[model samples]
Target: MTEKQFTIVRELDAPRETVWRAWTDPAIAAQWWHPHGLVTPRDSVHVDLREGGSYAYTMVEEATGDSWPTGGTYLEVREPERLRFTWGNPGDAEGEAPVLTVELRELEGGRTEMIFHVLGIDEDRASEQSVFQGWTEAFEELDDALVAAR
Candidate 1:
């Protein structure tokens, strides 16, 4: 059965380059990659930050110590503009992963508009609404990180 796809758009007060780094840099990404109440260890994050490169990270639930590992390879990379990659668990068999695309648009006053798209998600496993909520929380943390960096 085919799965559902989702797209989320967020506008940040930071510049495109800054937003790009937040997504591509392992240190910055680990700071905000998980939903609220989850903590990602900096040592568990790895990002190559280049086309054809791969990234892996683990997010642990704060109270339960449950760990969720996600890793994927970069399919396309356009610095400060867009990034396309596979999104899946590290143990998934080859060719069984979905795709995630992130597009960044530069706005006036160094603002950035980011579009996050995920394709081939199993709606039954994770409903669109739930995924949206997770991403929303993650982005909120990302916003805070960006602000703190400035």
Candidate 2:
């Protein structure tokens, strides 16, 4: 089977460092780590931000109380610039998981351009409630978190 990938490039109204913290700091990540209608409680977030380290979080659907647990190991970590990691169920084999890379570029006026890429999943799995849509909504949540932080 051919592996597929998707990339989301966003211009965020925050600095690269801020964006990096938002991803690496569990406290900050818990604010926006989930898609719309889902909540990632701060207690459910764990981040060990370093090469070979791992991170995990659980997103809960408020209405149904359904929880989705996700985690991954860091393949590469370059603070405020780039991060590459596996993304899948906690404790899953890294080799079998999809890889996600996030590149952050500092833009003019204290803003950032973030390039997010995910590899391994096919298009059919990238449906409305899946990877693509989930991240799209999560990013929107991140934007709100950023604004509130300012």
Off by over 4 Å in 1: 1-3, 122-129
Q: Quickly count the clashes in candidate 2.
A: 0
lDDT at position 126, candidate 2 = 43
Best by TM-score: 2
Predictions: Cα RMSD each = 2.4, 1.6
Show the lowest summed lDDT stretch of 10 residues, model 1: 121-130
Identify the leading candidate in terms of lDDT. Answer: 2
Quote the lDDT for 129 in model 1.
45
Model 2, 12-119: lDDT tens digits are 999899999899988889999999999999999998888999899999999999998999999999988999999988877778899999999999999999999999
Q: What is the TM-score of each candidate against the true structure?
A: 0.90, 0.94
- Candidate 1 whole-model C-alpha lDDT, 0 to 1: 0.87
